[model samples]
Target: MSSAMDIPKGRASYKKKDGILTLTDDRTFLIWSPMPANGPPTVSLALDKILNLKQTPDTSPKVILKIIEKPKNPDEQEGQSFMFQFTSPTDARTEANALRDLLSQLLAEIRGGDPNVPKPLGAAGGPSAAGGPPPNAKPPSNRWYDDDSLKADTQLQQSLLDKDLELAKTHAQALALKSDSISDESFNKQFWSSRVGLLRAHAFEQHQKKGSYNVLSTVKPRAENGEFKLSLSPEQIQSILHQHPLVRRIYNENVPKLSEPEFWSRFFLSKLAKQLRGERITDVDNSDPLFDRYLGADNSLGVASKITAAQHVPHIIDLEGNEENQGGFKSGNRKDAEMRPRANIPIIKTLNSLSEKIMADVAPADLEPSGTPESGAKSFDDARVFNQLSLQDLHGEREAGSIRLNVKDQTKFFSNHGDGISGEDAQIYAQQNPEDVLFEVVADLDTFDDDGAGGIDLRKSIGVDDDSESDHYEDATMSGIQKTPHVGSRAARRAAEQQILEGLRKARAEHAGGPTGANAVEASPMGIPPDLTERCYLTQMTTTEFLKQFWSAFLSSSSSGDSSEGGSAAAAAAAAAGELAYHVESLKRCVERIEAIAAEAERDRLRAAEARKKQIQEHYQKTGKKLKWVPPKGGRDSVMALFEHTTAAIEKAVALYRGSRG
Candidate 1:
């Protein structure tokens, strides 16, 4: 009645012990190795050790008990944790749910009615009490604010500034009429230099904000092939006119003669009007504060002034002239007709002082945005603790070598051969040799060891097959003569080394002399043996004839017997060595030819690809149409084609060498 579910072999390290689990009303969980007549349980854990439990029920059912282990003693290090897993019998889902409910009740009783303990695992599929998250759980913090919201606010602020500038122009015109101490000439001069200049500067600023300016027009190039045009909305055109009074004045004077679009288009395209459209004014500080004072929405400005301006200001739009009205000004001389309205100075001076006072009383605009949480906090430690799992400490401790398998008492299984060499000497030897010692050892051990019988079996002690005939010359050149494994004792190893040294010395002496069969064949002018004369004479024989000559030479070389002299074995070995040398030379020439072909193919592929890319770019420039890119054949394809041919040649070469040896 007190037993819990069974623990599987994979989930728990029962380690030669029975995986039986038990739970009692006293809140103790026991894992017994095996039941004895009168002994304590092998492992016992209190209910407090468990932090949470998770259950998974499917074709295979499991229960995961997350343990928050307490230190057995005060001297123990930090981060001891355990997660025990148990499996259920048939009717897994029902059994798991019943166990979960019982555990939840037990947890509640242990906590003495505290509701903050985690709910039992299987509750995920069931309906919960009519509430959201627990009150004790912390809410998500706003230290990392949304970047998109900040960007949107910045754009909105810039748009609001543009609207304010438009409203100020109408206010300036209204103030010109109401103030008696100011003349129109003085007011117009200052307004044109400061307010109108800043408007042009602001437009250029907006254009720069887009990262680049297209010289032809503001319309950006699109991916598709199509003609496009940029146009202004009615609201944008109105704002433009309010900001530039002269453009409005010229358009009004000509409105009776031209349509609105035609008049504005002509004005914008005209050379003289282009000169007045914008100025490269970097220092807005030198200009008057007329724009800021007349239309700023800051609270420091007088409420009465804002209210009066809002109620009484007439928007400064150009008055379109009729035939009778046009005649009055149209009849004038050229100089008189060109005369423009001037700004009043006293009204402008009064506005500057008022703007200065208002700005001084109000808070300055914040130039810098709020910083990241780490940077904004007075101390880094003041930042909130976000790690709620209480398990990250376990990972760090485990990596630091805690909970390692104790193998100190086990006997050594392998001897260290390199231990005899000092560390510095080993390092120096390794640095001098580019090839790794481990590969050298493996290659040495790969050769035929001495069999107890007299005949050489040529079988490896390590069970590796003999090296392929194609690799014989290359392996000899790169790795030197491979050593036979020295079995038995130190005396046996030394005797084997001495025997190998003697054989190498004798072979070198014989090789330095001509090969044993050299006297039997006459050499051609190209230094080819007479046995291979027909194959080597490219001008005299066709490829088919050369192949026939090669096959005959291969058969003769293989069938020929050794001389019956006292040095017959050495002479036979020498003839075999000569044949091997000839095969190696042929392989070298084949490799060179293959490399040349591969290189030429790669260069041609690159040139073709470059030409194709250039054609695409030119087409795009001529038609403004972007085409989907089609790649040329890569160099890998060309190289692989050459590789296939090279591989066949190598295989044939190896077969010929093997046939000759046979």
Candidate 2:
């Protein structure tokens, strides 16, 4: 419960008529009130219009807004002050002084005067507009904080200011990069290598740890032995089967006959039955029966001897019941078997007979001690034979389990304290009540790949073929599809088609200027001879046009057969035409091979694409959902057109050669 005096300063409640009181950076401060069937009524005073200021502390915490000058608005009055209440109690004098100082600065800037100069007092002789105390002012006797408290407060405020400034600088640098005000190289070299990037990286790491969409990389889930596994109770499993999508998929696909409990029981412990029924040995060894027996006996002895002397001691004697010899009498439904020793007289006689037979088989000289230590020499106590751990002694054997005693403390001080439930008894209790046991989950610190350590590729752990879909899901979820402006729409399709056609037109024009046939022997634009070029050029002209040009040159040379040089001219024309024909044939064959290879590659690409689509379809069918996908139909068509254009040009050139020879 807070009293009126405990109310925070600068808090105020507005009435229904008071729509809002807003202070904006647009060079104005105003209090608004609601108006029916009209815009809100505003009571605003421009910052420049404020001239004089006054403070009235008699009003307690509430304050009045007083001004000497009004704005050039017709509705406002000059030298009038309006009463405005804050939502909470506030210092009337302090608020008045702050407003006075602000108005003084604003007015000074507007009037082109020094803002720090004190303004003259009003007719009522109130405080000057500078909001400073008069000369030779006295400090108040009662202050909110003492000198020491104020100094500490100032130091904390300074620290906060420094931290805020540092943060502002970092944010400014980040913003500069975002707005492209700074070059990426410069930002990376400076700010990115600083604390900001490190902080962001750490935050991202923590987010990944807390199960982000990077689950594929981070989770590494394996039902058998993966880094991650879901430990669920029967009820949790049932809930998952009913609610979780993946679990439901598994359930619906298999175990149609089994109930929920039975299904999950088999799911969690499916290998148990198989383990109990051991794998059969395909090759039976009938030869060397003694060797086989020796092997089996050795295996059993090795397994049975695993229990340490301390562990074996618990089984030899009832450590739990040995507390005050509780085992000497009968417990539960059992009678005292030790009390009826006379009943085992036949067993005793059999044991005696066996002992006498063993003694008769031994040589007395061989059984004698071979060597003995000197009388004064100390002999070591072998822990294996001398160990006798009582229930209390067993309790604190494990590391960090014991209450270590100080060796320096010779004096003893004790109340009633007993080692409650010794380690042996606790072990018995744990075995009986296994459900209460808990195992701590500890992370393996060794980061090197286990497979790599054994000279195997660690990537084999992640089956690419098997885990591709899971990886795809993770990638899709993390970097999901974003709708772009130039995708899937009819306008976008038309734009894409136009772009492809324009590119093809440019390529056709470029090929037109390139050397072909006889011109191919000439040097290329890069000063490399066409003979050294990797590929030959096919003619760009149509078949009919090329034939007309070839024949005209041939006929002109034949007409000059009468002249002595006419024979040579005819020979040159014939050779040029024949060479062109041969080159055209070679080009046609090359085009055919190229087309075949391209067609094969396209088929392979389509096959792979179809396979991926089929995989997606199967996944959708399993999930019982359909989602929209957009592929670049225009781009694929454009590529096919380019290939067809090349084939058509080659065929035309070959056709031209056939006509010219005729």
Top candidate on lDDT is: 1
TM-score of candidate 1 to 2 decimals:
0.17
lDDT of 2 by residue, 324-397 (tens): 45533235455666674553443343344333333332222211111112211112212322344335555655
Where model 1 places Cα greater than 4 Å from the true spot, the runs are 1-552, 562-573, 633-636, 639-646, 655-662
CA lDDT scores, all candidates in order: 0.43, 0.39
User: How well does model 2 score by local distance difference test?
Assistant: 0.39
lDDT of 2 at 73: 72
Task: Give the Å shift of residue 329 in candidate 2.
Answer: 99
Report per-prediction Cα RMSD to one decimal: 39.4, 48.7
Question: TM-score, each model?
Answer: 0.17, 0.17
